[model samples]
Target: MQHFSLHTHTIGFDGQNTVEEMVKQAKKLRWSRIGIANHFIVHPDIKKATFYAYACKGNYQNIYSENFEEALFKFFPLFQEIKRIEQITQFPIYKGMEVDFFDTTQWKGDFYRIINLLKPDYLIGSVHFVDYKGHLLNTHDMKKASFMEQKEILKIYWKNVRSAIKFKAFDFMAHLDLPAKVGLGYGKEWEKEEEETIALLAACGGKAEVNTSALRQKDEAYPSNRILKLLAKYEIPVVLSDDAHSVSQMGQYFEKGTELMKNAGIKRSIYPIMIADHIRQRIYMDWHFMRVR
Candidate 1:
């Protein structure tokens, strides 16, 4: 059936399964392709993000932030492992990373340079934090909310999303309605921001994923009906993701996720092949990159 998934995690980061285990499960599921996208964030204040999402339970500083060069060094071997597995199994495995979008002004180093160096097959850009005038608003941590108004926090979330889209560093936007992770909704006040975000994604030839992980967490698909409908209205490409962290979770609830997406007006599924082709074309044409400064 040409089943494939581009958003998956492994022990390379926060996932439960190892790369080998994930591939074996994909083969059993009869998937035509599988992409391993473990977490690879870049932020100067990442150490300050003490929440579980960013902290990795005190392992973050040692594993990720301790040595930027060494941390990046650790990732290439995993890609090589993916390549080795591909050679043995002859299964299509695309190398990808789930990148954290931090405000550039607070960035400690050149993220774009690091991305180019990693040279993954593709990237999934996500904003787990909203840098509001220096204070961080974590999407996963609602208690630390510095904003007095809920809508204000929502607005910054969309603005950070806009910044990610404008940067054009990612193949697709992951979890378009991520604030929903913490019970935040796209309120009426965010209408203009939502519309403009969709427009920017469409203009950038970008796509968003109907992340099914939300089903497990929030009982809804990401990009919700409101955003998904606009994605359809704008004719923006959409893909589905299991956001799988374990072998069992691979393609978990995807049938329902696809149905949810179809109901939301998505007509096609963007697979890894399409993402690779898009990357190739962008490189060949030397597409103008918009760096968020």
Candidate 2:
């Protein structure tokens, strides 16, 4: 087993369990370490989003913020919880955020403020929303959409993911093919964006994770075997994450995730902070390091 998960969630966010409950499960499993990476999604127009998926009941718990400055205040307690947990146990538990990527100049400015203030132990960039014909579309809505509209969204989604990778702020990117589970990214129309994203990941020396959460729903992981092979071709290092929303899901199928990495020919799992070996420069501040290990 990998013995650690740098990407998992709990009740403070949209997850089903409390941080203490999740940590207790890890202790019982005797895991080497754990990372509490709840969602940190914010968008100036999120509340006014055209998509119905974003209006779900748990948006508040999931940390969905329409204003940047207000979101920072909300993050205070989540970070504080990490310190509180540390007092009760000596086991390693890192503080992290699975941030949704947005490319607007204003958004970037606010995002930089988050890094400067929150000071999370790590960040995982993700793309859960896409712009389609001037309307914001949630990838979770693809399952019900007509194929014609879905086709256009897939292109934007994959390119959105590339933009996130090129940004180079996260230790790793989450669920490269997030739409695959919803059944939208398998066509050849978006292959160029997908290929470009993989190439950009290799060039940027960014990291990706084999998210085991998808396997529990379908036979595939987030990147899928096809993309996993592509990541191997680029020699991008990988890590396993449960994307756990509950205690039982903490390490759900990590053994399988590791095997998938091995079969895909990925050779690195970020154990000693060796990301600088070939990741090149990421334009990050001295304090905000790239620690994929």
Candidate 3:
């Protein structure tokens, strides 16, 4: 029985429900607390991204930003409303962001600074976009890209996931095997990379999640059974998340998630205490004097 969820989105980003509506649903489930992790998609090249130009309907103008300071300012209203709701309902609501992990020194520097100032309760590291041949591609839009482009992007996508973990900018990883959604996750070419990622998480004392949303969208959960089994072998800390995008999605189908975890040999789940402390104590970035904590 999972008591909480930290992976959720609301109207401000790409979700259907309001914060108040989500909280109302949470009350019905009688959760201890929940985190509202809206998409924090501030990419320098997002304005130039060409994916889903015709395949998808989202304009994505308000959703992406190149300016970190402005983005932080824009998030203020959402956080304020969360605070108000917490006080009124006496329910614990943690401020969080489902960040799109970018593997650049500038991006990291800006991210670290903004997070320090925002002081969000938690952050989820995710790679929903991959830079492919000068154009940024959304992972979910994989079906729209050319076969050759998809092949190369899949390669880059896994590397980006690795970089995000090595960067240590967020609390835990999200949708570890997300590409499987588009029929590319369990490929022979990337199996070695998947093994390395699992080993990397264990070596770092890092945490991960069994995202229940995958079950809703597909036949299985994110971070699939094989990954979960390896996580158990490594004794890595795990959390179960609905990854809810609406009121109906909150704390739903956890029983199925638990069953998957059980089958995967994950005996227990953890409440992680550390954030951004990498696979190897600290990231060895380019700057010689810049010690990132």
Candidate 4:
């Protein structure tokens, strides 16, 4: 079967592989398309001096101090190279960012500006942090919060997702159940919130991704089988994303994810790309496009 993976990161972020090495691996896997959706730089306060010092501390430290513009400049050449390879190899490569979305009420401006400037072919919206008294509470920290507080944090995250969809800032919602993956320990309560969130996504004309990263964590894909069924009930399209941080992980666990989706009765999904504005308009209006298929 033909395969495509849209959520991958290379050395541009915390990923372990280079873009070329990733391409080679994807080719080995016979993937028809692979998108390099690295984490875009979000903070610019750290220069090379501070960045190296921060990296010395550990991966987690560097995660929060990413220099967005510097990362973009570093990755642009690799992106161009990937485009060149596509010309010869005909293996599709898409450019996009896995943007870290904090609460929209607080951090929306920066994300909005970056999206407008990049105009990426695809974008994945993810909530990696929650706000707490001017401090950034990551998912790791969020797990320690009280049950009520955890619910509030998830509610804010879902709210931010809704805003992202309303703004049309992303093509897919990445790792829809990221909070769950962190072992928030909310148990069944999260399901109710998920139901509401899935309904909201459907209303906003947005799609949710079934990220295979969770498979590596020894869990089923995010938005578990139950949530996937709820999404199907709401008619919210489901896309399978690997969230691959290495080339070998491209299209990884896709078979299992597709099987889960099939079991849930989800039959169709959408993949985003850069097309002419006229064509985009027609597609937006539900016009048939033989080429898109």
Best by TM-score: 2
Candidate 4 lands at a TM-score of 0.80
Candidates 2 and 4 compared: the better one by TM-score is 2
Candidate 4 residue lDDT tens string, 172-203: 78877777777763477667767877887888
Per-model root-mean-square deviation over C-alphas: 5.6, 4.7, 7.2, 4.6
TM-score of every candidate relative to the true structure:
0.85, 0.88, 0.88, 0.80
Regions of model 3 farther than 4 Å from truth: 52-56, 59-61, 146-148, 272-293
Runs of candidate 2 exceeding 4 Å displacement: 50-62, 272-293
Worst 10 residues of 1 by lDDT: 284-293
lDDT of 2 at 210: 90
Ranking of all predicted structures according to TM-score, beginning with the best and ending with the worst: 2, 3, 1, 4
Better of 1 and 3 by TM-score: 3
lDDT of all predictions: 0.74, 0.78, 0.78, 0.68
The pairs that clash in candidate 3 are: none
Query: How far in Å is the alpha carbon of 181 misplaced in model 1?
Result: 0.9
Please report the TM-score between candidate 1 and the true structure: 0.85
Clashing pairs in 1: none
